[model samples]
Target: MTHRIAAFGAALLATTALTVTSLSAETLRWARAAEALTQDPHAQNEGPTTTLNHQIYEPLILRNMAGEMEPALATSWEPSADNPNVWVFQIREGVTFHGGETFDASDVVFSLNRAMSENSNFRELLSGVTEVRATGDYVVEIETEGPNPLLPNNLTNIFMMDEGWSVENGAEEVQDYAGGEDTFSARNSNGTGPYVLTSREADVETVLTLNENYWGIGEFPLDVTEIIFTPIQNPATRLAAFLTGEVDFIQDVPVQDLAQVEAADGIGLGTGPQNRNIFFGLNVGADNLERDNVDGANPFADVRVREAMMIAINREAIQQVVMRGQSDPTGAMLPPPVNGWTEELEQYPEFDLDRARALMEEAGYGDGFSIQLDCPNDRYVNDEAICQAAVGMFAQIGITVNLSALPRAQHFPLIANGETDFYMLGWGVPTYDSEYVFNFLYHTRNDGRGSWNGTNFSNAEMDEMIVSLSSETDLEARNATIAELWEMAEAEMIYLPIHHQVLNWGVSDAWSTLVDADDQVKFKYFELN
Candidate 1:
């Protein structure tokens, strides 16, 4: 690791020297609060990871800055006329990977199959897929369990990998991100996207150069020829880098410093509401939480206790204080942009301290119990501060919250492993549908479904409805099922919905880009001033 870091630094210096002498306008220096977890596309389904991978890997379909579907690797796709259960894609021709491997239907089939593997973090996204096959050189077909109207929507983030290159590097299997396993794919990449990875130092810096032979060279802006990504965890340091012209872009601008950034001379701020909801999850299904003060049973298991905890949180206060009036207090797990979100579903209980206290007593926990809340300090805007506020709110009702604030890398695994009693998580529906949430958070944890459901709240009836949403061709029937699932989750208090995050991106005036509702910055759409 030491040698690799040293080599990466040397390579970056050389690239910087070359850019200083020539092609400076073609270079884009990007920084963020946290770096991508890994380079293996299927290893982690995280925002940073997916944002970084978008430059190197090409998904068959991609959501643009406006959150609308656009064709990329695949020119067009539609359900097969002979079989409604089968979706066919016409893969783009004349595309080549960074390593010179031609892009074709074989790579698509291999990549999707690899994503469905047990260890892949993206397995949940392909839950309804039964089989994938290459029908021709540039044609691929996916057969789901039933007639899935939204099958194409789910493929928006499924990136294509070079089958030959993966096999040659012995990385045919996906990286086991949760298991702490590493492979060559985690540190290397070869794809047909517009950018190629030149050098990478995990959690430090990654360098990319434009693919000279990119198929979309003339079609897209493709102005930025080089990219230097630096992950600076400190907000001050990151903002300073952008203000001082050390970096060209900063994805995550501190919410409190938004005004300062806007007032800065050479820097500009792009602000929008992200399609994500921040929430807290409790181990309600556990017989006895391993990290709670209560002995015989889990207090969170009681519905009244869960409701009491929910009502105790002051969402409006958190939005005004911790978020600096930049967030929208949410009552539902799905954000407004997500389908199946209704005004009634977004109605949360009124903040009633006396009622919460009384409910706690009624649940036979008048004395209140203690529990730990695992939160990620760097993943979301004011994530740690939100947890801190919740600590005090729960304390008002005699509940002692031992706040465990850690970086996202450490905080997320605890929930994935079911080690944390209560935890905080933020969800963004990449597919823009409720099924995306149900597959990962509501379904039973088994066979690649519910991979992130740490609460262990599993119901066979609910699971069946969730699975049926994928193949339910009737629009009316599918929407009704979605509404039913949301009602069930809300009534059970599966999670405490906090608020929807507001995005602020700080960028140099030298270039301009769109602000995606999903908070993903795709440089391909950027243009140099």
Candidate 2:
């Protein structure tokens, strides 16, 4: 009996491996509910495309399972004793890009410089570094304008592109997600990741294969890999694909289908509370056609109007109707895990229609006003439904929100350029630090940098707090700064924190390894059981 059981277990292992290996000979077959809109990481900041880009490009540093920064292309880094602002990194030797060209300090320098150069989306994240220099063959040093300590985590998107491949392909600058002319980085990618992009069918399918010459650990146990991404606009159609086993994984699982999916056989449901906050941004700085025309100015500018809008939002209705009880009404941008930052911060004023109407009246809008609410149709979980629900809630207070739903590729640029009035956005903390929030969303503009502050929101005190928080080595002081920052944001009604989404992925039992970090899936760690 013992020998028979041993033979059976061996056969099972072989069977599982064969099941994965027989898919496409050179490509492992994987499916997701959505397709990537763009292959460029710098160009594609939306959620769906970010996942596909994960398999195609390799960031300078990748996060480990514990959410800690680990070496990828860069082996180690050190801060200068004389000045905390000066930092140096040692690049790994003998590493090569996917195109067979050797990797060096020049690639790192070029990538950083390009990301920080003129008219780039990533400028805000890389703004602290006053200078980035390639010191030696495998060495690079960074000089910050001030003591910037979030460098390690910020390097997550600092993906290294092949200088030779990019130049050879005539791809110099990254593509504009909006309606920009053309650029090389817009389409093709050259990286040191585990997979290579064989072909990308925008909004339809993207296929990748194992990079045999990858520098990191061996290709995940799966021999060849193929990522099939399809963006389904209808929720029922997407759920049907997963139900019928047409697709292995669905990208954004609908909340209403949780119970039904749990009851299904041969289908596995994985869920975790995502470290992302879905919220709304009001244009308090400028006026657009999609805004309230009555005031002829940004209504969000008045703290009273912003506070009223926040109160009018019935988060419970949003949770029950749209989320289907799969989300938590978060009080702040940074979730609870990152220490005392969110401890004392008060949640946005609860859904009080009367209070909201009263505030609106106080702001000289007794009859309320009409404004356009720009939202992404396929970006977040039930994103359109959430916006639709908001329409009803806001209407109760006599505020007519004209909803303009568009794809994220277009929606992001429209809002980024300050063209939208009121918009819905889902933000994930890139650095896993509260300080990341202060820098990207709050800090006053020193130059043309600082992302997502399209509201042109500025506070000199907040800027000083962020600078002090960045360089302060003491954990307690840094956390205090974060707490103070949240308090100020709350007092000022910076951005409305809606709810923290619960991430759900529908998969088959055949796939064993699954790591859902902040809902950003990296395929390198995925392996066949």
Candidate 3:
């Protein structure tokens, strides 16, 4: 199945190259299962939100379709020869914001500082930065705590914002996403990207028009002049929109209907591996869960109970049945391509219901307990169904799981605010490194890091290892620390590993676009025939 998709992709690439010369301007109607939670660039770091924001905002560094780092707003960057802790960046010249403000180093300084604020969800990505200074009109310098080589990789998604525009609109500070506070920046945007936001009706539709004065006008394939994006939560309605030509592109193609879409005329299918891992999180540090049957203590705090829950989940069965062979069962939190990944870390004990039962009995949970499982129905592929399957498996062990499925907008805040006892989440490492995972998921929750660590698990030794990876210049030493941290994470069962999702994009035959491993659809790369 993978080979067939690769061949089809190659053929599509060939067709795209042959048709580029004759491409024309057209309106691209795109649909997805969920809408971007907010338009504030620094509020949310989720995939769907970032995908929508990338069209209007420009980051200092950009990850191309092939997952390679490339220059975006910043033309060139390198460590300062005089000081190893300071990195110098040369901002692009003559770039104007959508509202006609000139791009400069001050905007860069303001944007980076804004993202490092307490309300910014992207603060974890910039935890190592000590300061950001504008040396000149177009020259900026970033000083880290120590010698950091992966700073540029971390900034791939930290979008730049115009300082003047934000101040004028009374949105100088980042939106408090977890607090549910709405700001002007959440609905209005003025960026220097290839597209300008013309109309934005949250959760309904968004309209964008090409930036005629974009810096990369001729460098990219910017053939689509207008974009009309709609969020259709119902899978049937989304598929119907695609089938009837109401929508030209669908980022998420239903796995069950892949065959039907492939066999249908004037529809093209592109499949690839996504750089994300879906997992289950438990509040292991809490003395007593806020929403569970346990009386005085949290059952998840017991390693035996965690182990029992881990084995109760049959990942192979979920892969084959629920995912329809569209997922790769994984044992590690990070995917194989990420740094610090090894075959030894990928091995998991085979599923055994009998062993799980014995462990539960040994942990004084033979009678089992009931707990609420929070899941997002529209976030990941078959997420609610996966949770439903786990509920049944857990029932065999005398555990009753009350499933609570909600939209991504409502479901994420529950985890972000540490309100849910158990929840489902999917993580993607944009930096392609284990340090990115450790910094956000394993580090202790604090002002500088662990914004997403809802599990409430913390270790002083593990925190030391995680912090050392940022400043350690030696490659072997850094990797060793990463391995040690993973060893602790696996032994403690910080998160129950599920599987890596597969990317399936459904597009009309009238257009061609690359399938990114991150599942980000950049319409700037789209070519219309």
Q: Pick the candidate with the highest TM-score.
A: 3
State each model's CA lDDT, in order: 0.86, 0.69, 0.87
lDDT of 3 by residue, 297-318 (tens): 8999999989998898999999
Clashes of 2: 5
Top-scoring candidate (lDDT): 3
Any idea what lDDT model 1 has?
0.86
Can you write out model 1's per-residue Cα lDDT over 261-304, one digit (the tens) per residue? 76777666776667789999988898998888888898999999
Model 2: per-residue lDDT, tens digit, 332-421?
A: 776644444444552556789889889989997778778888899877888888899889988988888888999776788876677877
Worst 10 residues of 3 by lDDT: 14-23
Residue 58, candidate 2: C-alpha displacement in angstroms? 1.3
Error of 3 at 493 (Å): 0.6
The TM-score that candidate 1 achieves is 0.95
Error of 1 at 187 (Å): 1.0
The residue ranges of model 2 lying beyond 4 angstroms of the native Cα positions read 1-34, 81-83, 219-224, 287-290, 445-448
What C-alpha lDDT, on a 0 to 100 scale, does residue 258 get in candidate 3? 89
